[model samples]
Structure formats: C-alpha cells, structure tokens
Target chain A: MKNNIVEKIWQQHVVHRQAGFPDVLRIDFALLHEVTSAQAFAMIERKNLSVQNPEHFLATIDHSIPTRKNRHEIYDKTAKNQIELLRKNCQNHGIPLCDLDSSHQGIVHVVGPELGITQPGMTLVCGDSHTATHGAFGSLAFGIGTSTLAHVFAAGAILMKQPKVMRVHFNGQLPANTYAKDMIMYLIAQIGIGGATGHVIEYTGEAVTALSMEQRMTLCNMSIECGAIAGLVAPDETTFAYIKDRPYAPKGQQWETAKSYWQSLSSDAGCRYDQTIELDITDLQPQVSWGTNPEQSIAINQVIPFSNKTKESLDYVKLKSAQSIAGLTIDWAFVGSCTNGRIEDLRVVADILAGHKIAKQVTMYIVPGSEQVMHQAQKEGLDTIFTEAGAEFRMPGCSMCLGMNDDKVPPGSRCISSTNRNFIGRQGTGSITHLASPATVAFSALAGFITSSYAEQQPQKEAS
Target chain B: MNTAIKQIKGLCAPMMIDDIDTDIIIPAQYLTQTSKDGYGQYAFSRLKQADADFVLNQQKYQTAKILIAGDNFGCGSSREHAVWAIQELGFQAIIAPSFADIFSNNARKNGLVLIDQPLEICELLAAAAQQNDLIISIDLVNAVFKTDQQTFPFVINPFFQHCITEGQDELDYLCSHLSEIKAHHQNAKGQTIFLAGAGVAQ
Candidate 1:
C-alpha cells in the first residue's frame, strides 16, 4: 500500500497495532506547560507512577506567567500556585525545566524548535493544543489532554486511532502584503471550524512551499484552530537547513545521516489520500476575523455580512453588519502567541513600525514568543523600534493569548490580535477579539482600528 | 480513571444548537480552578445565563445523565475540562451526529461514553429528549439507545467499547506491555533522534 508522508511517519512510530484498536505509538518527545501539567503530575503521583522516560520530556512555564514589568512577582494567586506546582513537579520527576528565568524559557511550542528539541519523523505530544506547531518539521505532533499526558508520562507512549489523511494544496502565489497567517485564516474561513475534524492535514503546493519554516510553523500552529488533529509540510531543503546547527539537533556525521533520512520522508509518488482539497490563492486577500471564531473570517477588504451565525457573534462582539472595521477603533493590539510570536513575526512588526508611530488612541503590546526571541529582537533593535513607536515591548510569555496572567483585554474593549482563537471572552471577561496576521495587527495598531496591510503597502505613486 | 460505563439509563436534555464548542460547554474562566469538583454547576453556564429556561437548568432535566446534542458536538479546543464538566454534571454519555476528534478521545479516556449516530437518528433523539415522559437507555454491549417508541443504534470504536465495559484505562493497558515497549527501544538503531528506516523492531 502506498503511504503519504503522514502514514509513513505513523507507521515508523507505531509500536503495536491490533484490529479494531488504536495503535500503541511511541512518543519521541513530550512537552508540558504550567497550566495543564499540574493535574497530570498529580495524577502520576496518585498512581505512584514515576516518569518512565524523564529525559524524553521537557517542561516550561509559559501560560499563567506574568509578562508585566514586575521582574519576579506573579500577582495572581492562581498563576503563582500553578507555576510553583510545575516547578515542584519538574523537580520531583527529575525532568528538565525551562523556568521563567532560563534562557530556554518561552512558549512551549516556540522553545521546542528554538532549542532544536523538535525534529522530523518524531511523534511529539504536549498538553497544550498548539503542539501541532512542531508538525512544520514533518513530524506528527498533536495535543493531548491531562489524562493522555499522564499516560504518555507513565508509558512514554500513547494509544491513537489513525486519522484519515487530507491534503490541502494551496496552488498559487499570494498577493503582496499577505502572510502565512492570512493563508491559514483564509483556509479556515473557507472550510468551517469542523472541516478537518478527523483528518491529519498535509499542506502542499506553491504557496505553502514558499513559506519559511517559521511561517510554516504558523500555518501548522493554527491547524488545531480549524479542527485538524495535526498539520504538516513535507520536509525539504528548507527544513534541513533550518534544523542545522540548532542546540539539540544532531551534529557532524549525525547531521549527514539525519539529513539523508529526512530526505526520504516525503509522500511516495501516486500516494492516495482519503481526501484532497485544492485551493487557488492567486487572488487571496489578507484575512481578519469579524465574528467570534477563527472561522468567522473575511478578507480585510470584504464587509462583515450577516451569515447564519453572524447575528449571535455580532451581538457578543457588539458589531453590526456593513459597518467597516477599518476605522472602528480598538483599545488593544497584541502581537504574540504560540501562533505568531516567533522572531519572524517580531521582525515584521518592527519593520512596519520602523519610522512610524502607534496611534495614540491604541495601546499596542509587542511580546516575543521566547527568551531567545526577546534577546534576538534586542540585538536586532526590533525592541527599540516597537518601544519608540509607543508599543509596550514586554517579557516573553503567553501574554493575553488566553488571558490567564496579568495581561488581559479589559471588558467590552475590542482588540485586534495576532494570536489564534477569538472565542467569546477568550482574552478576558466581556472582551472582544478579532484575529489577524501580525502584519495586519501592526498596521491596525498604527491606524487605531482593524485595517489591512494591503492599503498601507499600496505603491506611493498609486496612493498619490 | 473510572472507565466502567456498562449501561446508562436516564432522562436526557436536548441542546440542538450545531457546533457546540467546548468553550460553551465550560468557559475558559472556570478552567483554572484547582479542583475538578465544582465544574458541574458551571456546565453549560453560558447557555444557562443566556436562556434562563435552558434544558440543563430545567427542574425535570436537572439530573439528566445522558445528553443528546447536535452535529459536530465538542468541536473546539483540546480542553479535557469539557469532558469533566459534562461528566461532573452527571452526564454518563453523549449521543451526537459526530464529534470533534480530540474531544471524543478525551471523553473516551475519561470513561464518558461517546455514541455516534446518523444525523436523522440524532435529530430524532434530540426531539425525544424534549418529551417529558421519555427516558433514554444506552446499552453499550449492543451499541444501541432505546426509547419508548424507537431503538437507535450507534457505532463506538471497539476498543473504547471494551474499555468502557471492562473499566480499563488505556494507560494501564498500554503500560502492561512494558516488555514489548522496552524491546522496541532496544531493537531500534542507535541514536533515537528519529526512527530512520522502515524495519519493524524485532
């Protein structure tokens, strides 16, 4: 039987399989964060199960950690307790931890690739859903709940029923000013939130191939947003080049052997998928969410229409159909998350704000995904650009993504954010969030409303 | 880890809204609570707040141990709290037209039975849930739910069905194959960075 890249990786990792039962798959790496790991650790303790392969796992304090100016104190009692529990749990289990002060500290997904802990042809599991971001390296990565995390902790494996393979081919060049974030948002809007519910989506074609590894990670990061178990791009020269010289990646002769192995991991010729979808993006536009969900997106140039679900979302968001979001004004513009907080996202925001100033009416927050990202931005003067432009350059953490920490969108205030997921009150109690690419968020920050980068990027001659 | 879910018989409430995401099942605000104990009161709290007479809050359906929901139920986020909330609210099983993959997996691992029925049957059940005299009885061994006037069968993954009936957690079963797991690692080539070739472990 011919297998796609997903099946190939699945077959390589499946330790045992039986008819009508889920395959027992080995986990190459298991990641944990402060928010979800405590319960799993408690469960492991209750069962008296020691961490089976402690070396194979890594823990980080990301969610529920404050990004505020206070260097150390976590004001929220719940956040402080969760972080403390994670530290205690990691110490008890002898697992490596990237605490808040560590150089490796960052969002779990960001730190994984940065430390070279993520690699091709491996099965990665994390308690957080954005673990799919690792699939950019041609790995099978998906989120597991606390119970499943404990299962992996005890056995270093997980039981999984194989998902059907679906290939989404983006077969054209994107117009200027569009980014990978737009590509994913557009795809999600085309296929409703439940479109890829049971399929492992493999994104292919010219548009997907043109995206850098960091951009590809952004694409995979939102796979869960649109209901995919995992999304991946086949490893190629870009993938190999990106992995080279990373901290945890194999070096020297090991690198050569790994490169050869990765080269052979693509889909076989004439591979058949359970389903294939071809999207032509020759005229794709920068996408922005107008309603309450990630799938409730429209082109920045398009009007918010009263679709079947729009009335309910609009009522919550306090928006009316036909009202242009461009000059609607916003209270917040956040630029970070597991989805778009990578250095590349930071550089885009910096590049946009180089000579410009953030609108006085809007309060923009620029957060790097990891400690490395922070240092890199400082070295590159991106932090200076943002700070001088009136945006607050904050510490590395999952800031305002789900509003677990000190940074939160005030109630009833509208925000244009680069983070994925615009679920009702996700950013805070009674807060309204609109999702967009980092470029769009940056541009909107300057406009003090939800505006598209395309208008900003129009040729000066044409604009004049 | 209490996986025993042999038979469940009780009144069920119908939430006919499509794409009922996990956030609505239990909001993100309630997730940070240290204990999983009080999630029951917050289950469908959004709907209860939105519509005062929501089915889950109704006096008759307050103790519903089964839920008949719309298509594509449990469709957002990988939060296991969705399952805990539903389970804490005394729902033993959820019968739906379909379920999101991760949510369904979480439900099974936590011993909450997920029954997949066709859209027509689900709609029928949803209507049946509105009938005050109707009681829903789920027979997992046979994979069917019985009402006074009708019998609708559902398809459950065989292994999940076995686990539900036998009260076996998947982790316990997987860990029992410790020898096999160790041998798998031992048989692999040195440097387990990536499982390189196509050969199965001896």
Candidate 2:
C-alpha cells in the first residue's frame, strides 16, 4: 500500500497491535522535564520497574526554574524541591540528566535539537507537549503524560492510535516580515483551537520548504496548539545539513547510512492523506492574538474578531472589536518561549532593537531558551543589543513563557509575547498575553504596543 | 476475568466553555508539587476566583462527580496534573464534543473517563446541568450515560473503556513483551539515533 511519511514511520515502530486498541508504538527517544517527570518517576517506582533503556533517554530542567538574576538561590520552595527531585530521580534511575549545574541544561525542546539528539524519522516522546518541536527533523514526535512516560521508561513503547493525516500544504511565497510563527498562527486561527483535533499534520509546499530548519521547528512546535498530535516537514537538504555535525548525531560511516535511509523516508508519490488544506500566503500578514487564546488571532491589519466566543475572549483581554491591535498599548513585551526562543528568533529581535530604546514604562523581557542559546546570543552580541535597549536579559529556562518561576506579568497588565499559548492566566493570574512572532514582539516592545512590523512602528514617545 | 467498572453515579456540572485548556484546569503555578493528590484545590482556581458564579463553585455543584464541557476540552500541555486535579476534586468523567489528543491520553491513564458526545448533545447536557445538578450514571461496558431525562450513548476507544473500567495496568502488559520491544530496535533501522544501524543488545 502507498503511504504518507507518518504511515511509513508508524508501521515501522508498532511493536504491538491488538484488535480494537491503539497500536503499542515503540518510542526511539524520550525526554523528561522537571515539572512532569517527578510523578512519572514515582509511577515507575510504584511499578517496581527499572529503566529499561536508559541510554535512550535524556532529562533536563526547564519549567519552574527561575530565570531571574537570583535564579541560583531558587527562591520558590516548590520549584527548588521539584528540581532536586528530578536530579535524585535521574540518579536513582540511571538516566543522564542535564542538571542545573550542567552546561547542557535548557528547555527540553531546545536542548534536544541543539545537541543533535533529535533526528529524522524517530518516534520521540517527551512529558512536555512541545515535544512536537522535534518533528522539525521529520520525527513522529508528540508529548505524553507521566503515565505514558513511565510506560516508555519500562517498555520503551507507548500506546497510540495512528492519527488521521492532514496535509497543510502552504503553496505560496512567504510574504516579507512574516515568519513561520505567522504561518502557524494564521493556520490555527483559520482552523480554530480544535481544528486539527485527533489529526497529525504534515507541512508541505513552497512556503514550508523555504523556512530554515529552526523555522521549521517553529512551525511544528505549535502542533499541539492546533490540536494535532504532531506536525512534520519531510526531511530535505536543509534538514540533513542541519543535523550533519551536531554532537549526538551519527558520525561518518553511520552518517552515510543514516542519510541514505532518511532520503527514502518522504511520502511516496501519489500517497493519499485523509485530508488536505491548502493555504496561499503570498499576502499573509504578521499575526497577533487579540483574545485570550492562540486561535483568537488576526492579521496585524485585521480588527479584533467578533463572535460570542471571541467576545468572551475580548472581555477577558479588556479589548473591543473597535480597531486594529497595531497601536493598542501594552505593559510588557516578552521575547522567548519554546515557540520563538531559538537563535534565529533572537537574531530577528536583536536586529529590531539594535539602536532603539524600548518605550518608557513598558517592561521588556528577553529570555533565551537554553544555556546554549544564552552563550550563542552573547557570542553574537544579541545580549548587548537587548540590554542596551533596556530589555531584561535573564538566564535561560522557560522564562516568562508559563511564568511558573520568578518571572510573571503583574496581574491585569497586557503583554505582547512570543510564546505559544495565550490561555487565561498562562503568564500569570489576571495577566493577559498576546501571542505574536518574535519580530512583532520586538517591534511592539520598542513601540509600546502591538505593532505589526518595525516599518510600521510609531516613533517612540518618551513618557512625560 | 475482568475487573469490571463499578457503576459511576454522580451529579454533573456544566462548564460549557470551548477549549478549556489544562492550564486553566490547573494552572502552572499549581504544577510544581511532586505529589499528585493536592492539585484538586488549585483546579480552576483562577476561574472560580475571577467569577463568583462559576459552575464548580456553585452551592449545588460543589460535589459534582461528572463535568460536561464544550469542544476540545482539556486542550493544551501534556501535564497529567490537569487530570489529577479534576480527579482529586472528585470529577469522575468529562463529557465533551471532542478533546485534545494529549489530554485524552492522560485522562485514560488515570481512569478519568472521557466520554465523546456530539456538540449538540453536550450542549443539551450542559444546559440541563446548569438549571439543576443532573445526577448521571456512566456504564463504561455499555458505553452510555443515564440521565434522569434520558439515556445517551457515547463513543470511547474500547481500550480506554476496558482499561479504565477494569483498572488494568498497561505497563505490565507491555513489559510482558520485552523481547518483542528489543527486536523492534533491530528492525526499526535508520529511524533511531542512539541505536543507529547498530541495534541494542538483547
């Protein structure tokens, strides 16, 4: 039978398939994070299981770790205990962990791809939902809960039904000033929050091909946001080139074998998908969330949408359907998350803030995704550009994304953020988040409102 | 022999909001605890505090055992704490038109039965529960819910229904096939990095 990329990979790793149950799909790699791994460790312990294949897993700390100047002290007792628990659990289970003390520590998603642990065609699982970010490498990756994580801990497998496939073919030149973040946001808004529920998405066409690997990761990172189990872009030259020399990647002889094997992993010609949605983005605008959810978004030029659901969102966000969001004043600007906290995202924001001072009274937070991102941003002087522009550049973790740590938006303050979700109280209780591309967040922070692009930004008005 | 589900009987409350994501169900601030049991207090803490009349906070529905919601319920984040919170707060099941895939998987593992009803049926259920705390009974084996007004059927994956009803453990089942799993590493070539073409030792 002819098969799409997902089908090809699913068939290969299905170790067990009962009549009516979902396939017992084998997991090639797994990641454990501080917030979700502790309970999973407890579950493993309860089951009297030892780590079956410890070499196949790597653990890291991200969520609930402070990114503040005083991060080393771990002021929150709960955060400190969770981190310590993950450390002890990894040690007890014989799993390799990038503890707070390890240079490898970062957001679990960021750490995986950067160190080359992510590769094409692997079925990867992580306890955190952003594990879909690794699908940028053509892997069949998705997030799982602690039970599934422990299942993999003991069996190196998970029970998952093959999701129906939807091909989101983006067939047009990417409009200037628009990034992969814009493309994904537009797709989610068009499809609603539940648009692709119970589906697996494979991004294709001209627009997808043009995005860099980092950008491809950005496109796939929010797969969970649109309700897809995972998202994929077929591995091509860009994908291969990106993985060629990273630390954990296969070396010389194996690289030859891996490359040839990966080359054959794309969807076979004439294979059928359960559904296909075509999008033309020649004129797509930079997107920003006007309401409280990622799907409550519009093109920078569009008005806050009108609907009963959107009305509820608008009320929560304290906005009207009155005008464009381009000039609505915001209290904070955050430029980081698993969604847009990569090097390319930093470079874009750095360029926007190079000589510009952020607007007065507008707090700006620029957080890298990992320690590697921290050093790379400094090496490229992105940190200097950020600090001089008056944005706070903090140590790397999932800083301000979910804001479980020391960083949080004060209650009732509105923020332009480059994170994925804008769910109620996601950034903090009573705080509001507007999701946008890093470029949009950068320009908006500089202008003190939700600006579409730097070119359309207002001249900074110093507060009297 | 089956570890059959005891009939789950309870009062159902309505939270008809679409996309009631896990973050809202249990906020990230509540997730730092390594213990799973205490999250019930934090469940919907943000919503209940903001709105004085939220359903779960209502005098009538305080002990509600079944919660009904709109489409894509339990969406966002793979945090099992969301499931734990609802279960701890004494919710036995979530009835929805649809659910996010990750949340559904998490729900199954914890015996937090997820019943799939059409949006119209869900709306009906939610609307009825709003007027009065509707007592409902779930029969997982039969795949239907019994309300005082009527009996409505629901769709659930058989595996989940079986596992939740029987309280069966999938880990032990998967562990029974350890040899098969090791062989999969050998056969799933070029698809893994650590194993590469060099398979894992049996």
| Every candidate's TM-score, chain A alone | 0.96, 0.97
Query: What tens digits encode model 2's per-residue C-alpha lDDT throughout B152-177?
Result: 88777888776767777777767888
Q: A382-450, model 2: which lDDT tens digit per residue?
A: 999999999999888898899798789999898999999999889988889999999999888888877
* Residue lDDT tens for model 1, A1-464: 77899989888778999999899888878988877777788777888888876777888888777787674797777677777878888889988888877888989999988877788888899987778899999999999888899888888888998889899999889788898899899889988888898999999998888899999999999998778999999999898888777777777788888878887789998999999988888998888898878888888878787666568789898877876556557789999999999999999998998888887878899989999999999999998899999999999988888887768899889899999989877898778999999999998888776777523432112111
Candidate 1 Cα misplacement greater than 4 A, ranges: A454-464, B1-3, B131-133, B189-202
Q: Candidate 2 — which residues are off by over 4 angstroms?
A: A455-464, B1-3, B189-202
In the range B76-161, model 1's lDDT, one tens digit per residue, is 77778889889988888888888888888889888888888877877877786787646888899998888888787777789998
Q: What is the lDDT of every predicted structure here?
A: 0.83, 0.86
lDDT of 2 at A296: 86
TM-score for chain B of each model, two decimals:
0.88, 0.89
Q: Best-fitting candidate, measured by TM-score? A: 2
The model with the greatest lDDT is 2
TM-score of chain B of 1: 0.88
Measure candidate 1: CA RMSD: 4.2
Q: What does the lDDT come to for candidate 1?
A: 0.83
